[model samples]
Each structure stands twice: as structure tokens, then as C-alpha cells.
Target: MDSLCPLTDAVIGDFAREDAAQLYTLVGRGARSHLKVLRNGLEISEMAVSDLPGNPNAVWTVKKNIEDQYDSYIIVSFVNATLALTIGDTVEEASDSGFLPTTPTLGCSMIGDDSLVQIYSEGIRHIRADKRINEWKAPPRRQIVRCAVNRRQVAVALSGGELVYFELDLNGTLNEFTERKLFNADIACMTFSEISEGELNSRFLALGTVDNAVRIISLDPNDMLMPLSTQNLPCPPESILLIDTPNDDGKGVAAVHLNIGLQNGCLFRNTVDNVTGAIMDTRTRYLGTRPVKLFKVQVQGRSAILCTSSRSWLLYHFQRRFHLTPLSYANLEYAASFCSNQCAEGVVAISASTLRIIAAEKLGVAFNVQSFEHRLTPRRIAVHPTKPCLVAIETDHAAYTEVTKTIKRNQMANDVEAMATDETEAELAREIAMNLREKKLDERVFGAPRAARGKWASAISLISATTGEKLTYFELPQDENAKCLALVQFSKHPDAVMVLVGCGVNEPLNPNTVTPEEAANRPVRGCVYTFHLSPTGDRFDFLHRTETPLPVGAIHDFRGMALVGFGRFLRMYDIGQKKLLAKCENKKKRYRERERKRKASES
Candidate 1:
């Protein structure tokens, strides 16, 4: 098993990074900035900062000499008001020798190896080696919110939630641009990454939106900015980082690490498919009640995570099976900023008045650390018959009962005082237990009619396929808990009927439990109800109901037989003959065992 290990710590400034032999930072206080240099975690020298042309509160990019072949420079702004500031021979050295007349008023900028692409508030511009190469104006009043760029292409996120892609010429000029929209949601942040190194490598754009969703768009020539997939988040995200990771075969970008920073000081870590950009798995880590910055690091030939949050910082060692081991944590007086090393096992973290070279090997383990975990649940989706429509049933509440069951099952085993709590919680637990007991009795009886039950309600809405209009709405009965919905489409019939599956223990089957014969004569809890859609499609008529052995979650028709998913099994029944045709156990235990084996092999 991998363990989290603490390496090093120091104090310095914000906006930091580690180079081959030293750490660099734009450090100072108040309105002044200084270039601070540190070697081996000790501050060596500090150079006074100089103001360049254009506004200082600007979006910028620092393209460092990662390969030691080219000099580092900071590119700021777009078009006419931008400038490039050259870094000196050392971290404490700064030069304004590469100043350019670039346009300002931009929200995002990308500095390439030898080029820069920026998105202005209303347009985009390209520059090559301190020279104005090209510029393109967007449609009137359509503000550009964010942007991501590579060597050959650029993606612009508009205020109206549309994304625009531009193909770049050999001279680093815009050749042409295309625009498309997905879900029409406001975008928060975006980052671009090439799947692998080389000319034929595929590129992907990860977009964070205000609607708490992240989408991956392919930048391949055949599908420029085409949305591959999306994952809905539990909270609104503020930033996104796409880290290229090595596969089992030591190939880069075989698995892409997507880090999404939520507004509530939580980070969502997802490993995504390199080509299709689908999320393979997900894990959550809570840092604090503030935003987090995620960085990828390699230590001792293994990948890791460096996260910085308000007033604290942590270094986590990434392990197999998406396990993150906390190596070390530090409390800071001020918000911490992180600068990562691409080719070394160290990072420059700055906060308050301290700067330190946090080496991976120097990290230490803290006892009793807990990881924030969440279940990546799948939603139920049902398609309408004859109509090109789909309904996504939100079922997050279904798991609550399962949790209550677990708590109740363990309550008797543990001490009474340990489980005792407020009166409301105690009452709630009792209620859940009663509900479960009644439901189990109803299923065991398997033969009685449904009785008048207390009120419970759900809604079904009809939406127009062409106009995106909500055409009609209907409320469900109060007596039952709705579990599933399906539309029966028979080609031989002129109209289709809607089927709803519900389960509720409205009445007990031999409440005394002593009379086994009376309990056996009662009907099951699961109910299959039918509704006839009116010709005008605005109303529905309750038709009939039938009892089922298990709480049906889904229904299908195959070869004129009703196939039902009743709890952990499937049953096929002949409606005309009113007899059971065949039944199959879902074998949930066997499936779980197989899944465990598969995961064990993967680890």
C-alpha cells in the first residue's frame, strides 16, 4: 500500500514555480511586487519589480523555459495593449525588453512556446514572437468570457454559453472560425491539453460551467470543439485542471486527470478517457471551506497531487484505484499559493510571508486523516414510445433509506448512548424502520389488494419535442411511492399507454404476524398501474392495477411479453394468458463478487 509522506516546508510569496535548480516567485506586499529567488529552500536574492505597459490587473501566462532551450517570458493582455516581459538569467532577474503594443480588455490569455493567443472582451487576437500576427472580431454584443489555445487552434467561450473554435494558420494567424452551443450554459473556466506529445497528438478542452457541469470537447481536426461528454457536479465549479498522466505502460495521456475545484472548498478528481473524454471514475477530497488549486506532480517515478486551499495546504500521494493518501498538511496564516515543478519532485509553496521548497520525499503522515468520499451514482433514464423524447428520473433520495437501514442494523450492536441523539433523529429512525417492516410484510404476502393510503405525490410533465415547450402536467396518487415509468409502444395499436410502477405498504398483511395463512393470502406491495393518454394529450385516465412480487424499478416488452425488473430479479409474464412465462434471478451476489474480482485485478 502507498502512504502519504511529508517532505519539506518553507515561507515566501505567492505565484511560485520550481525550475531545474531554483524556485521563482512574484513576491511582495501591498502595491509593490518583487522577484524572489530561492535555492534549496533558502531565499537567495530579491529583485525589485518593474511595471510594464498596460493595466496590471490583467490575465497573463508565464511560458517558462521548461526544456532549458528557450527563455521564459510573461505575456499579458490581448491585441494592442499586451506586452511580454523577459525573465533574466536567474529567478531574481526581470527585464522589460520584450514589450509589445498589445490590446487590452481581455479575460483570458494563452502563451505558447513562441506564440500567444488571447480572448478580449469582444474579440480574439494572435501574436507571434512579440509581433501582432492576426485578430478576429466576434459578433456584435457577444462578449467573450474565457478561452483556451494550442499551437494550431483556439477555443473561445462566449458569455451566451456558446463555444467558438478557430483554426490557426502556419504563421500563427486565424484561418477560420466555427461556433457551436451545448446546453447553452454559462462557462466558468476552461483549460486545454494535448493528449500526447507530437504532431499527430489529439487535443482536448475541458470546460467548467456555471451549471455545475464539466464537458470535454475534442479538438481533433474532424471534430473541433465537439463535446464528447459531460459530468454533472454536486456544486458549482470555479476552475478546471487537466493533467496528462501515464498509463500502466508508461505512456502519457493514456489517462487524463481532471481536477475540478468547487466553490465549497471541495475538489473532484476524475480520470477521464483520453479519446472520448468520458469520466472513468471519480473521487472527492475536501480541503477547506474555500477554493482549491490542483497541481500534478511526479515523485520517485510516480504521479501525485499538490493541492492548495485557504489557510492550509496538503500534499497527497496518488495511489492505485483512485486512492489519495495524504502525505502531509500545513496550516498557514495567509492563503497559500503553489508553483509546481514539471521535471522534479518538489514544489514552491507561498503564503503570508513565507516561501518554501516542499519536496515530495520530505512530506510526513498525519494520523486519523479522513478522505471526503461520495458515491458516483447513475441516474435512471427512460425513453418515450413513438415520441422522440427522454425522461431522466432524479433518484437521489432512494439511497437515504438504505443508509438508514445500515444505521438501524448496527444500532443494536453498539452502545445505546453512542447511538442516542436528538428526538427528531430518533423519531425519524423509528419511522424508517416501521416503513421498511411494513414493506417487507406486503411483499411476503404477495396476493392482497392495495388499501387507501396516506397522501404522497409526484409529477409527470409532457414536453413538446419541436418547440421545447411543456405541454401538460399530471400529479401522481398520494398512496404509493413512484419507482419507474415506461411507455408501451405497440405498432399494431393506434395509441400508446403509460405504465407506472409504485410500491408502498399502505396496509399490513396480518399485522399480528401469528396468522401465517392470512399473511400468505395478502397481495404484494409492488403495483403496476396503467394510464390511458387522451387524444388531445393533456390528460390521462387511470385504467387498472396489478400486484407484483417485488418493487419493479423498470419494465420492458419483448416478443409480446411483459419483462419486469422486480427488485433483484426479472420476470416475464403473458398478459393474455395471465400466467408467468419465465423468471430469472439477477444473482446480485455473484455479480458483486465478479465486480470485486475485477477491481482487485485492476489494483
Candidate 2:
């Protein structure tokens, strides 16, 4: 019962160091809250506009996302502070209107002593959360391509591997600044870490790429110019992460996960050392099995519990201390979610269509079986350092209460009820008209923003729900799994960064605004899933990227569990968390009835 994860509002960062129970998650736009979290099964707080100094324009900058993890309940994102979300323990927004970012919003999953948390975005000194907040200037030109912040400094990795590092003051002001040329490689992701006791002096960057290579570079405040690592791998790293382990250095270990095959498999054992980016030993191999799509699990000491694309559980261990380990196939068949030692009751996160805490106990000598489930399936799961036994829980709280189908169907009738008494005067009529219109501020746009309601091998599209305009389109890249592309806006703005993701055609598009038909026929437009979006106030077209496919079977306005399946029967999915929350079978009678209704409607 796996759900299409793209639609789930997952908080991907880490928990607080003192306590792993502090969870940070990403929610929908236009809501009164963005982050919904609870501690000890009690509602703690929801991140709202009260946390920032300003609200972003409803016309633009709506979908806020936590791109990556940094530090204590830390995250890096391009959020519209105007979001009606939480403002931590002691923070306030500039005004009542939701907008303005005050500080880091989410956390990294790894915990322990001396762990580093960082995030990157262009910010401006402005009134935020009532207390003059540094409004991160949402750039219409370069929408935060890459950013890395650590104990010593903050770095930004642009599209062309251009890196910028900044040292901040106590008041979060940039003090020292420097730039470097890290890679000619299309920089897919970048991270900064201080693997040594002297992080301020000894720091390095781990960069992942679609070109089947991971590059590690040295960071020196004096001669901080280029990378230090010289190793190259056959598999391109999709995510190069620096995490805390029960190992030495407290500096932790690095995991570079990538999609290693053409159409069949994934290489899960790509772990590296934090200090030296070279391949570590004792790598684990989970051969043949099946192909996995998306996987999220934590590494606890020598024990590695994994949930693959097959949605099965496999716990691996090795005698030697190295990156690789021998695979331990789970005699257990049903896989609920991922396994982690961080939970309160030795529970691992289990996901079907919904996410839940499934407790695990030693079934036999080398086998472990899970027990009961938790109260709620965490959209994002994490355990606290202070309370490793007590897990942090955030209810699958929706931005807004789910609107009933019957209520929505009767909106037109419920709304224009007083039409007969409306005035003819322009001002009076305008006022009346405004009162009758549905508030646009609360609309949930972009279930599938850039694409239309159709199926294909792959596609690209550009759509602006605000303007009801879907401009761009294309197909999947020949190289599946992972993709790296920049919109080749020919004879146009050189600064424009296009997330060019079309099928096969790597060629550029010529400058011409012909009819939609003409543009469609242009060889450049083949399966283009390009969405031309720019940060408000600027006039440069920016590219959009989606880690997973958008909602396929449901409409944009839908807020119910979509039973997404591969065969004739689909599994029930929890749309909010984005992970398959539970397994639900479609009632034969109900499904047949639905089909019958559709057939009658056509008649």
C-alpha cells in the first residue's frame, strides 16, 4: 500500500540534538500553518506567519519546500515567510499576514554531539516577524540553486559549480565572504562539513552529480579555492549526505546513494568517509532482488535496516568496519516502513499507504520482528537525542480541513443565493461580487503543476496556476532514474536556469513565439515538462524540479486517500505524508458503482 510520495508534505530534515523528538515537516501553501508537530502525543506547535516578518505574494511564491537538512531541527528551503507556520519557541512574524522567513525552519535527521546544521538562500535585511527580520530576497533570477551551511561557514553551489562561502556574526549577519570554482560538472547537490575537531580550519564539500561521479573538495579560509578529493566512481551519486554515526571522529560518515542501473536496479551501498571522500571498506551488497523507486532509512551503528522499492525489509550487517557490508535478507515478508533505533520502543518507521511506528523485537537469533503500531504515521520520522525512547510525532495535519464532496458540489448554489438583492452601482456591485467569489488565497494549486491530465513515457511542462497558463512541455530523459539538465533558453537570458527535462533531445530551443501548435511541432518541444516560474519581483524565467511524479489519478482539489495501484487493484494512499500510509483494497461493489456512474454520465 505505497502512496505516490510527491504529494505528501514530508519534513525531510533532522530532529533536535538535545531531543530527537522535535520534528520539522513541509506543508502546503495558503494555509494558516506549514509545520505541524507534536511531542509526547501532544500538539506542540504549528509554524505560521507569526514566525516571519512578511508574507509572500499569493500570485507567486506559493509552494514552500524543505529541500535539504542542515542542523538541529534545521532545513534549507525557499519558503514564503508569509506562510502561516510555526515560529519556533521565541520568534514572531513582522505582522499578522503570513510572510517573511525568520530563521532555519527544519532539521537534519542525524543527531549527537557537535553535529552541524546548515541551509542556503538569498536573504535581505527587512522587517520580519515584527522584529526586523532579514527577508531572504526571493530572487527572480537565481532561485537558490545550491547552498551549504555548517559550524564555521555557509556556502552556495550554483548551477555551474560556482561556490560562495560566507561567515556570519552572532546576529546572523554575513561577516566574511569568498568564492570558489568547485566543479565543471553539473552540480546536482552540494554539502559542507567539518570532519575534524577544528571545523573552522578543516572543512570539506561533498558534491553529488547525475554524471555518475561524486567529488569531495577541501575548504580553506586562506587558500579556499578548489576541491581536495581526486577519486571518481562508476555510479553517479544522487544524494551525498554527511551524517552522525556511532563511529569515531564524531565527524560521522557519508552516504552517496545513487540509481546505478539503466532500467532495473539501484546501488544502495555507496557510503564514504566524512574526512576523506574516498570509498570506505566493508560495503554491503543486496544483489538482484528487485528495482526500488524511493527509499528513506537511517543507519544505526553496524545495523542497517532498509526498505527497498519492492517495499520489503532487509537488515544488513558485516564483521569488518567499512563502507560495504554483507546483506542479511529479511525472513520477514511484509515491510511496513523503515527501521531505526532512534524510536522510543525500538520501533522502525513502516509505510504501506500510511506511515506508522512498527515496533521490532528479536524474533530469533539473527531475526527481528516488529510489534504494535504508533498513534500516527509520521509524514517525516525522527527520534530525539535527549529522549531516544520517546519519538517525536507530528500529526498528518492538513493545511485546511478536508472539504466534503457534497459541500463542494453545492458551492454554486450556496454562494449566489442573494443575487436578486445585489445593487447595480459599480462600487456596490464590485463589493457584492467580491463577497460572492471564493477566496483565491486558500486555493490548493498544482497537484501536477507543469503537466496536463495525460500519460506518457516521460514529460516536461510549464504551468502557472495563478494565471491558468501551462506554457512548457517534453518527455523523460533517456537516462532515467536521475536527471541533470538546464533549460537552454537560446538567444535569451544567460542567467536563466532551466531544469531542462525532455526526452532524448538535448538540443536547444530557438527564440520564437509562434502558435502553441507551431511550438508543439518544434523538435525542441518534445515531451517538455518545463515549468517557467520566477521568484516574485524579478523577470527571469526559472526552472522547477520534482523529486517524484505529481498526483496522477486525483484532481488538484482532491484531499482524500487515493488508492494508487499498478495492477487492476490499487492501494490506498495517504496524500499528505506522500508515503504509502496503508494498504487499502478497493471495494468491488463501490468500484463497480463508480464506473457505472461514469458510464451513465456520458450517456
Candidate 3:
């Protein structure tokens, strides 16, 4: 497969230094609960913990006492208790007194080595390793729909389109900052930009609503939770992403690129003014027929966008040009989410029933092959000089019958001659003759002999090279097989490009009735058909046809002249005048002189 971008599956445990290599997830429910450790996407170990109650509402990995090493323990929180399972070790119970007995854990995040934040139906709780707990409750009648966390801030969206922001202090305490409600909308999804170096908070918050619009909110202390701008959309967005690019004007403010994936499978892109938050240079592209989901992934050490729809597509830059192509290796059917923080060079795709970790690498070259109907066999192709299209010669089953009949007739005649030879070969020839007789009887019992249907049918197809789609086709006359194809512009229609096809008459000869010399000297007839493509490149218009005395075997363009090759000779003709311009015969003297002149020029 020649691919514009190629991706390969990552080896198991490829991210030894990252948390992706040591993934932990809960399987089954209640007494059947099992903790499975995964490397890449493959399971490496499993431990059953029947003591844990019910299904775990939240699972997260917390670092152990290894500062320079990759070691972590799994934290499984249930409705009533929390269990800490050490890797390849024993399981111990943690303090669950801080959590409400009935509130389910909606999400979880780690702020530091000792602080863990868990989102509940009613509020958020900060649980430290030393059993100290701090909590914050939402306003009355508000339900949390989504939450996004960073090292220094946490943003939560509620059912009534209200957004709450919390600032995490140096000691891992959550302080209520500000809250705002989006008018006439319901929140669907929200995310905060990553905190950069020397920065104490995320710069921006992107929110998607059920009313088919997106709003950018400034996270700066001066304008916390303030709406910067809002852009209306045709469909509800399913995902949102914001990427920061370096400032090129030396203005100290970086430019942010906004990407939104919509419910109708279209991806929207624009530039967001970091200072003003105004959208500019908006563009939209259709990716697939299903709803689109976007994820920021790392490929070959650079950040790229992975869009999931009917099939997975990757958007990245190569040699200063951006390329968006389908990933050949990953088919994310009903994928729930993708985790890149665990694997920097690849991604771990999570679905309802499976987890797939795939690594991406660059391909030297990429090409696409599209298949046509199985009844037609493509033999030769010629590309159009000026259009993004090509012409192909295709044959059907009737053409196959014509060729098969010729071979069978020739073979039977040879067998008959062999039987009449010396007696030393009589036994072998007799067996061969018996097999042929059986085959003949079988053919008679069957529908019909191939000779009875030995009629060739060939067609010229106009295809788009850019998309590998067959636009239209022109079928030839019955019993004529296409031998060659060419795209040329004639003097009569110099501005128009046309297709020229060389066709030979299908005439099955019986070897038993025709002698070798008679077959060799038989008159061969063929025709050269010219066709013009319509303005839309969808259909072909008949121009004219020229009858030839010999079977036309090849066709080419000779400096705007039609160069036609018969069995043993080449002729150049002026198509407008229908006059022969030049002729070259296949003779020994001409061939020797041509070869000698070519060798002299090389020396």
C-alpha cells in the first residue's frame, strides 16, 4: 500500500518509561472483580480481589516511593470503600470515611504525590494519602456533566450550562474561583488548555454546548470565566481542542489554533486571537459520514490530531504541507476515548470491549488502489496529459472465451498429429486423446462449447486518477477486443483531448480445417476508434473510426500525430487529412541500421 501516511502497531511494553506501559483497569463486577495490568494494549498480569465491593466507580494510578523510577499502585474506589493494590503485591484497604456512602465517583485526577481529587454527583473531594480530606459542594439544583483537570486548575460543567472554576493551591487545596452560566444552552463537553512552564494556571477553556456552538473563556485571573467569543455552528460539536503556536510577531502573545469535531462528521478549523479570543480564517472539511471525535496525539515526537469517525484519520504536516489521510492500521469501531499521556509515541484506544495501542511511523511512499467490478478485467491504462483522469482497456467473459477457444483448437490439432506418429509414443498419445474425448463429452453435456460463445467484448473506461473512481465507460462493438489505448490531441481539435483505442476483430479459426500456411496468410482486419470526453469528464462522445487492413496492435502520440502499429509495421497518419504521413516496415536491414545508429550516438 502506497500511503500518504503509514502507521504501525506499537510493540508490547514499548513505553517502559511512561504510564501507558503499565495500565490498570477493573474487569467484571462485585465478587468477580479482577485487576488487569496491561503493557501497551496486551494484558501482562491479572489479580482477582474479591474483597472489593461492587464495581469500581473510579480507578487511577498513584506513584509509589520511587522518584527516578516508574513504579505505581492502583487505587480502586467503590461506593463504600477504597482499595489500594500494589503492583505484583498485596491489596490493602484505604480510608473511605471522606466519601459519601451513596455518591458515585464520576471522575478522578491526581494533583500531587499525596493529593487525589474525585468528582461526585453532588460535589468534589480532595483525598490525601495521610487520610486528610477537603471538599466543595456545587450550588443547589445543579448537576455536574463534565470535568477537566490540570496541574493547577479544575473546570467543571453543569447540566444548566453553568461552568465552575477552582484553583489548586500549592498545598493541594481547592479554592472556589468563579462561575458563569451560558445563556440558552446546555453543556456537552469542555476542556482546559495545558499549563505551560512557569505558568501557574491554564490559559483558556473551550466549551461545547448542545445548541451547536462553542465558546472560548479566558482563564486569566483578571477575566476568570469571562466569555471571550462564541461561534455558532451547523451541528453540535462532539469534541474540542486548542493548540498554542509560537508568536511570530514578537508580541509576547502566542496564537492558538482551534479545532472542533461536529456531530455531522465535519472538522472545523480556525485561528483564535489569544488576547481577544475572536475567531478568524474559518474553514471546514468533511471527513466521514459518522460523528467525528478529535484527539491530540504524539506521532514521531510531534503533536498531531487523530480524528475518529467511520474510520480513523490523521492530520499532520510533512515537508511544509499538511496531509490528512486514513490510518490503515487502526479501525476504531465505537471507540470511547484515546489516552496519549500513557504513551507519547502512540495511543491507547479504549472501546466498550477492547483496548488497542497503536504506534505510528512514516512511510516512504503511499498509493491507493480502488477495485472495479469483478466481471471486468483491466488490461492496459493510459494517463491523460492535461486532465486528472486516465483511460483503461477492460475485457469481459466473452473475450476470455475467444482466447480460450483459440488455444483449445490449436492443442487438439497438435494431439491429432502426435497420435499419427511413431508407435513408441502411441500409449502416451492415446491417453491424451482419451482425456480430450472425455472433456468434449463433458462440454456437450454442459451448456455449450466455448467456440459457440467465442465473441469478444471490450470497453474503454474513463477514470479519475485523483480518487481512483471510474466515471464512465464506452463499450466497443461485438466481437472486437481492445488491444491498445492512448490519449491524444489531434490537429482538427487541438484544444480538446481525446481517447484512441486500437481494436482487433475476434475470428476463431479451426486448425483442423485451415492449414498453417493458410492461417498465416489470412487477411487481418481492425479499427482505430476515436472518442472525446465531455466537459465534466464523465462520458465519452463518439468522434470517428478508421478501418485498417491489419490488426492494430499499439497506438502512441508522435509529436501530435497518430502513430498506429500493425502486426509488423508502424504508420504515422495526419488524422485531419486521413492521409498516411510516414511508414516504417519491420525489415532486417532497417532494424540493423537503427540499432547501429543508436549505438554510434551513445559512443
Worst 10 residues of 1 by lDDT: 369-378
Tens-digit lDDT string for candidate 2 (281-321):
42334433454322223333333443343323334333334
Q: What is the full ranking by lDDT, best candidate first?
A: 3, 1, 2
Candidate 2 stretches greater than 4 Å from native: 1-132, 135-140, 194-202, 244-265, 268-603
Cα-based lDDT at residue 269, candidate 3: 86
Which of the two, 1 or 2, has more TM-score? 1
C-alpha lDDT (0 to 100) for residue 178 of candidate 3: 48
Q: Which window of ten consecutive residues has the lowest lDDT sum in model 2? A: 56-65
Total backbone collisions, model 2? 102
lDDT of 3 by residue, 1-603 (tens): 322121111112312232222322223221122222232221111112133345453454444322413324445556655555443343344344243445555556566555667777677888676868788887789888777775567788877877788887776678877456555787777777766556777788889899999998888778777889999999899878776644434356555778898999899988988668788889898877788877766544445677877656777655544567666433454221222234334454433233344555553223222223312345566656555555667654344343454467568856775767678577667667666645444221343343233356577777654344668767776677677888777776687777888887644333266556655765347788888776556667777788877678898877777888876667776564343344444423467788999999999
TM per candidate: 0.43, 0.34, 0.48
Error of 3 at 244 (Å): 1.7
Task: For each of the candidates, give the backbone clash count.
Answer: 28, 102, 5
lDDT for 422 (candidate 1): 86
Query: What RMSD, rounded to one decimal, does every model reach?
Result: 23.6, 26.1, 17.2
CA lDDT of each prediction against the hidden true structure: 0.50, 0.33, 0.61
lDDT at 540, model 1 = 53
Q: Give the TM-score of candidate 1.
A: 0.43
Best candidate (score: lDDT): 3
